[model samples]
Target chain A: MTTPLMIEARGVEKWYPNGFQALRGADLSVHQGEVVVIMGPSGSGKSTFIRTFNGLEDFQKGSIVVDGITLSDDVRQIDAIRREVGMVFQQFNLFPHLTVLENVALAPVLVRRRPKAEVQQQALELLDRVGIQHQAHKYPGQLSGGQQQRVAIARSLCMEPRIMLFDEPTSALDPEMVQEVLAVMQELARDGMTMVVVSHEVRFARQVASRVALMADGQVVEVAPPEQFFTAPGHERSRQFLSQIG
Target chain B: MSASPNLSHPQRTASPPRLHRLRRELFASPLDGLITIALVASLAAAATGFLHWATTQARWAVIQANSNLFAIGRYPIEQQWRLWLLVTLLAAATGLSWGLLRAWPRADRRGSAWPPNDTIAAALLTAISFYVPLALHAQAGIQMRWWAITALLLLVRAAAGRWGPLVPRQLRPLLALLWPVLYLIGMVLISGGLGLMPVPPAEWGGLLLTLVEASFAILLCFPLGVLLALGRRSALPLLRWGSVVYIEFIRGAPLITLLFLGQNILGFLLPGGLAPDRVWRAAWVLTFFAAAYVAEAVRSGLAALPPGQLEAARSLGLNLPQSLMHVVLPQALRVALPATVGQFITLLQDTTLLSLIGLLDLLGVARTVMANPAFLGRNAEVYLVLAILFWCCCAALGLGSRALEHRLNPNTVALNTSAHKA
Candidate 1:
């Protein structure tokens, strides 16, 4: 690929204090505009691995470089990396006290020290893009689950992040509401936003992903295009996981 | 199971008659009937006896004669106008706050009705309860005229609620800024600072002293408590440990002992034996003591918040302070509001302990009045008045906190229920 690398991680390792190892030397690299989806069983550490990309989770030993800025123990570097990376969670954790527009506009105004009027205008545009412009003045609690998730997406997009991480973004949605969020993610992918998603939706992976990575026991065991990963299994664990889910 | 006809449309089933409901509740069985009758008889007897005593036996002469002492203990008579001016300022501020609050648009689209019936009723009830006794017993002269003027100012400002929206948007910020300025002005007027005749803290007493001490303590302790709460949760070990130690030490000691120590030992502990006034010492002690409790309250609030909220804020590039100030604390403080206000009320009541340390708060002045040979053996009247005053203040605080909680959480059931009704 001629595109520049957006994220690079080498030998990431994380261990909880209770002696449980969540991640053990996991490595993945994504070029700009590439969509990488990590699929695994519950304990395979897919969530933990992506969380480390934005410095949300601490790793015992690993080096991560995002958008040419290396993630280190330094607070300033962590903050800088966070500013460049945006994350969406399964629960759609919007600030319940603030209006939908305020939730999207808050970080830019507070963290970026941008003018309120400019940020709010941008926030409204993002909300419109997510198809919830009418619900902008309402609090998060007043919105439907799908609407709230879409607002969450708009909130992340307002930062104009170079890399977006999704940790089971649709896993918390109702079965009927999943497609609305998936549709938004698909749109994001088509727009050439670099994305890392951890989800169980094989259809999303098959449709939107540039490459699919399989995780097993705290490590990425296989990385391949969706057609190859789904139709022809390279690893025994991958074959077993597909059969179990099916 | 077959569906009953009433179950299919419960609302269509007419409620049982009130007489039948009453009978079912009070006389379902022989024993129930006897118990109800016995309880009713006892309640009636107690009520009648209290009414008889209140109407005929209780002498309010002591309260009537010492109203000035109760309002502003030992404040020189010449400076009494300053107290009246303070009252007028407070009345106007209260009205303006109420008007502005009502004028602010709610998120739920329900318009704030002007001259809200319940609020007006409450104000009238409070005025009647306090004013009736004073009118019947006390001489109606300068004090009464000042009271009328205070009430007039309050009415005028509250009427401004209807026009609060008409206030220019540019001037609204100034309106918000006016509060702290007014508070400072109040302090200066009370203490006679900035070219006015200075009044010593020793001369401050009665409800005036109690209120001054409580207000200052509440204002100062709230931020201190929030900081201490955050410090307790800090990743830095020193700050966490220091907060833990302070909270524990203060919570471990009794308030009375702290008050005594503040009055006696705090002077020696300060550099160059710089003893502040006794009132100042008492107020500081109350502030520090209440802050420990407030910290615990706020900590509970912080604990109730989901871990995801902080993570979301951080992922948006907010540093710890920005994340906390914008997202975490607003939600946590809302959760902590009831308990924090509870601490404030307790702190206000705790100021009564200042009397024990030689400062004459409301309780202290009451004791002084009871000891006067002219008002000998009027303990019931004196104590009753004091209890009523304290109750009024505490109840007002409770109401204010409830209003604040409603304002902060428009998503709460309180607003939802109103919306449902609408």
Candidate 2:
């Protein structure tokens, strides 16, 4: 339990301009190589909470520290934090204009200013790891949804971040194609990559998640290991959530 | 294996013959046939009369006599060689750029055949257009030889296309560098700066002046428009409101008013009665006017993008500029292409407004030519040539933009072909 902390969130709060609160006093911490899964019903702020880790979503109140860099209003700090944290969204937001290889190779070459040849080689290897190396030349639109998601993963992996965040990554995917994306995530987890995933995939949670955090009403309600969380629920809401899903 | 009919070999539904299709479309009902016949008769009658007038009655001597004035305005006759040299350089640069652009690996891989047939056709059409005009009017000796040399320079583009791959990858950036250098050279040659005899902007006229104005306006306004659009969407209120105010204020006024303001009042507005050249003032005014529209066009493009694209870019550690340059603008600009090109064509036509303020642009030159007592009532001939010139330029802009849209959206092209097959 004494591994280095990769992410630390304290009392994170966010509100839309219409005064609807999305994240309220949310707090969580993840150690290096730990896999944390945030699960909740629709509109429970699980997605909102995870998005804050990478500075993709701004919080009106609260502080998030990723890999020792604190997230603030300073763009430079946000950029630095984002450099160490990778995120995957439900929509798979791959750049449709660029080829799959270019998608993976772009950030490293652009943001990191890495040598193109070296970054491309690393990109091709990452694409291979995700089992879409053959689709490297194709645009994102040309690939299957599953393949596009894998390329998105490869694109994130190419940055070689200290932490990875997945916000309902498989929610938009077709049921038949879900397993392929999950398999890549599972492989990623096994490689000891610190990940914070917000998904309803119970099987993925059971298999790879080190801790499952239940969120409701813009806050994290419970955090426990999957074995304990699934078997015996301390909170009444957790039991209610489990039974409803079943 | 069970005996079954192969679905792949299903009977094809052959389309009806072209003649039958045409007959059904045009003559389906008695009313349709009657309407079609009436329309065709009127069109043919009008066209025939127009053709007869154009061939026999139209006096083209005004256009012939004033071709130089139309092309270069009052640009000195001795300094005309500079114009010819500029044309030769332009021809070579355009040819080489086109070749190198087509030779670029990403553009090449998008399945267009090398030396695209349509491009060749466009080139031939352009060549014939230039040839017909010059052959009909240009004084034969030096002008014809310069024409020949310009045509020969254009052939360099084809040769470069054929062998562009042999160009070293490291040296390809020089192709990009060539443009700004050429632009500077053109400025120097035309305006006669840096050790050459200076030509005042007042002396600059005709198509040359119109082109210079339009080019400066278009080039300057694009980046300004992009910045303004970004500013309108900025997180900071000051930047956002400032952009909104500027865009609205400029958009509210008509361009002619802006030009007039530039011509008469702009000099006084400057400190110490410092007046810029009329051409500069007109160009700046046009740039400001066009920029507002371009900003709106680009804003629409920015609006159409999903927020997820920006989020993903930021999540990748790309700063705002990097994200915009690499991801956001490329897609947004593609979406904005048609509208932006439309604005550019409008701006180009808007240059004729320069004539209203005493600048002798293409349209102005035509008016001056018509004013000549020798060519006193050749309005039809003069106006028709002017219309043709404007039409050619606008049509080329439209066609070029479409080609660019196609090249940018390779995925769309692939999807279209697949859809067509389906």
Candidate 3:
């Protein structure tokens, strides 16, 4: 009864200017402290759907209400929404000029106008949490892919965001390095943060995510508890995707 | 598929038979050897003549003695120290700026350190300090004020360098603004603001005029260039068009034409009677010319900034102006700084063209002195010194630009290192 529904999306659709409809009508609902994983083949609108939640990508027709704020075309609201929804990209967009500590501290200092001392302390703590505290003074270029991804996570967490979104966070890493980033993510999920992850790492989804949502051709083909979804997917498209990706 | 017997034989590890090859290359034939020898002899003769003229036979001692003649023009011998002090102040400022920017936090131990360019700077400053005092011995007693002014300038520079970091971010912008104030003070002091001191524009000659023209133009034009660049990219159509017209129209013509227009037509254009100061008008015209070029450089800087930077700043909730000053402009101006400095150097060299309009700058003074009966046939000597002075100025600007470019883009250095090793 106390489960708080943090995000609700109904009939989300995106028709880009060039007449490519990247997303079809899709409905999703996520609860507080729940991990949801979205898996799909390439060009299935998995990334596009997640990007819309943070307002990085706007949809043409949809109703998305996150944390009680409704999505609108108003740019101001988009910024406000972005502040609460922390996103980590496949390519860690850490500012090259800034050291790891500075990169983590930037949003807090610039966005929240936090005191420098407080922000620096929080930045270091987040870096420690991500297991890159020792490399705080080094730039993103100096770090390994795994370390950079961890720093990116730390940077997002520095905002103290309400919800975390990971868009193929480990996809760019080498096979050996991918586990380190996934392990950090696994720790975040265990800590009971609300998270929506778009990833192909099926083992990660099976172990952590409460529900697995399978998307195909811009539509959610299946949504079921991971145990049932993987073992007995209802839809033929979901069954085929699992066979291919697994 | 069988190997040939000669090829299958193990190669002997031995030197080939040493042929007594002639040292001469293709010049073995009689006609070629004669032509090569003649060419070598002619080159040697020319080299010897150049060395003798450039070093041994040059009248450097007399030129050194009358250096003030080339440094500051026919200004009263008594006021020569003022010009010397100004040069020393500028040199000290150059040194201080170099030191401040090159200084890094003590924490960065693993980072590569720049070679001590500051020592070269210090040596240059010392040379100026020594030369100024030695050259102005006649007026050294009474012109202690000049030395005091130089010391004050040095103190300001040192203070700015040392305490600059401690100044709040809000005040750092005002740091750039201080140059205009300092320029005004120097101008007033030189133009008889002090009852005891007086030097008119007509008398302001030599390298001092070059400095005056360059520094004044930079102070006036740099800000105008920024405005024009911003205006050209403005959302308002009227502003964009106006700025584009201004920049393009000025750039389309030559500097001499603008100077001529400023001298001849400016009085008629304005209702207020134009000031009778030809040098001021010329400086204004040069500043106008420079602003157009500077605008183009700044526009390129603005264009180079990533669109994400602007979006990020906006999403941080900063207003348009705040985002521009805090985020967009800072990065853009860093990209633009070296180009602006290059333009400043070009403006300095272009100041020599002021001689065409009868202003007695260093080149003007040199031409005047050469035309006199006393210094007849010394055009080569005067022009040689002028060329050396101009070369030094241009070289400093070039080096400074390279250093700044290296700092801004260390990836270039990294790429070069990898290329060199490979």
Using TM-score as the measure, the top candidate is 1
Give the per-residue lDDT of model 1 (tens digit) for B169-240. 768768777778988998999889689999988888899999999999999899999999999999999999
Check candidate 2 and list the clashing pairs.
Answer: none
Candidates sorted on TM-score, descending: 1, 2, 3
lDDT at residue B86 of model 2 (Cα atoms) = 92
- Candidate 2 local accuracy as lDDT? 0.87
- Per-model clash counts, in order, read 0, 0, 0
Tell me the DockQ of each model, to 2 decimals. Answer: 0.80, 0.74, 0.16
**What lDDT tens digits, residue by residue, belong to model 2 across residues A119-230?**
9999999999999978888888888999999999999999999899998999999999999999999999999999999999999999999999999999889999999999
Q: After superposition, which runs of candidate 1 have C-alpha atoms over 4 Å from their true positions? A: B1-33, B119-130, B133-136, B268-275, B413-422
Clashing pairs for model 1 are none
TM-score of chain A of each: 0.98, 0.98, 0.98
Q: How many steric clashes does model 2 contain? A: 0
- Candidate ordering by DockQ (highest first): 1, 2, 3
Candidate order by decreasing lDDT: 1, 2, 3
User: Interface RMSD value for candidate 3, one decimal?
Assistant: 3.7
lDDT of 3 at A70: 91
Residue-wise C-alpha lDDT for candidate 3, range B279-353, written one tens digit per residue = 778888888899999999999899988765665444334445756776678668778888888898899999988
TM-score of each: 0.94, 0.93, 0.75
Tens-digit per-residue lDDT, A160-194, candidate 1: 89999999999998899999899999999999999
